[model samples]
Target: MLTPKQARFVEEYLIDMNATRAAIRAGYSEKTANQQGPRLLEHAEIAAAIDAAKGARSERARIDALWVLQRLVFEAEADLADLFGDNGELLPVEAWPLIWRQGLVQGVEVLELFEGYGADRVHIGRLRKIKLDSRVKRIELIGKHIGVNAFRENVHHTGLDALGDRLERALKRNH
Candidate 1:
């Protein structure tokens, strides 16, 4: 069984994977958190708890690198114009698809004016904006995932040829 402090530490670590910060959030002394955090991770019980928490979080969110890549590369695109009405009113949230709707809005200010008056109430509400992810960037990331050197526009060679070159260099240095 893990101690209360250790359990808290595991919970905090999963937030952003910063050991020192987790220790501090788990009620450890700030002065000692830096050291205590890593030490807690070394404990068997604490480590298992962290792994279990990570697994549970993954299962709940169903999010992985592949899911992210697919969302970035293959998901449907949304336009800001489609999300708003011509009268400067935001359309219903249901208009947006599930995935695109998450970040599909940016709130803006709409100032109303009364005739012959200084000003009316300022309305604060959601405004639609183009939030499309860059297709080029997504494609580049996919390229990197498949071992393509995006910078040089070529594939990275880490096979026998690279090893043979290193061996030749070492042989020359030994001579």
Candidate 2:
């Protein structure tokens, strides 16, 4: 069981996961909130409460590690070809597949083309640009989560290899 202030702190902490801010919002003195926040978290009851709250939130939102991984995989596999029609023109948003509409596209820019200037201008076709989230970045994130080094540049040589070569040359010279 927690006091009202402690319960308030738990609720406030859930808002942003910032202890100091939660402490202040929970009515702790600003001068001591910085210390009080972490101190409160150290209590077993508080920690358990926080865990319960997080679990409940995740359950309500239907989000977990598996859901996150699935979303990342979808983003990484999203194809731009799906956004175009048979004639190579971009398809309307309504025509896009649900996966592309939901996750792949970051934004859409439509620039209305016109003929002439000012009052003499006549309406023309519009230019549509679709901004896609970076597939490479999504793959990288998925790789990191799964412990795969997709984007990491690995150098295979250990410094000991060079040292061993130098030692071998020195021994040959002495022999």
Candidate 3:
């Protein structure tokens, strides 16, 4: 559960407002919104609650929420799917981007997803760490577009758990 102010900020941000805008709407200084916005979003419980709300969200609202969530994580837009199936499947193959900018091709749908997301160049500094090839990552994206089809019917909508699992496994394999 978020504080009233925090909750209001999240609610406003979910509607397509940036942190600065949301902060202003939530009755905070626009400058403070930048500092406070990331802190509020960093709360694990708050994130979990937001994810729960987004899971059952109407298709239209869900898409909107996806835009906000992508901006929150990657600080940029993403190509995440819009319509989720009743069986809890992502109808759209597009997933979110990871700000990866590289010259090598990998099986990473997040690259193309970012391109589709209309992510801004405002924060290219932090996003520069990702290494996505100039050429589309065809093989990586061929079957992993959604990156969460691994779930059965009881699947979670945002697929964070699945993604975390994959990331953890990859990290273990790497080191």
Colliding residue pairs in candidate 2: none
Off by over 4 Å in 1: 42-45, 76-100, 104-132, 140-175
Instruction: Pick the winner on TM-score between candidates 1 and 3.
Output: 1
| Weakest ten-residue segment in model 1 by summed lDDT | 104-113
Give the alpha carbon lDDT tens digit for every residue of 1-175 in model 3: 6779878777777677476677678888776777876766677876776666566465545566456444334422222332335675534324322333221323333322233334563423212122333322333333244454443246457988999999999999999
The most accurate candidate by lDDT is: 2
Candidate 1 per-residue lDDT, tens place, 1-175, comes to: 9878888889999999999999999999999988998999899999899988988898789977778767655543445466667886666667655655664343334444434434754554444444454556656777776667754465576688989999999999999
**Higher-lDDT candidate among 2 and 3?**
2
TM-score of every model versus the real structure: 0.50, 0.75, 0.35
Cα-lDDT of candidate 2: 0.92
Clashing pairs in 1: none
- lDDT scores of the candidates, listed in order: 0.73, 0.92, 0.53
**Candidates ranked by lDDT, best first?**
2, 1, 3
Clashes per candidate, residues 3 or more apart or on different chains? 0, 0, 5
lDDT of 2 at 100: 88
| Model 2 agreement with the true structure over 1-175: per-residue lDDT tens digits | 9999999999999999999999999999999999999999998999999999999999999999899999999777767798899999999999998988886888999999999998999998899988887888888889888999767788887799889999999999999
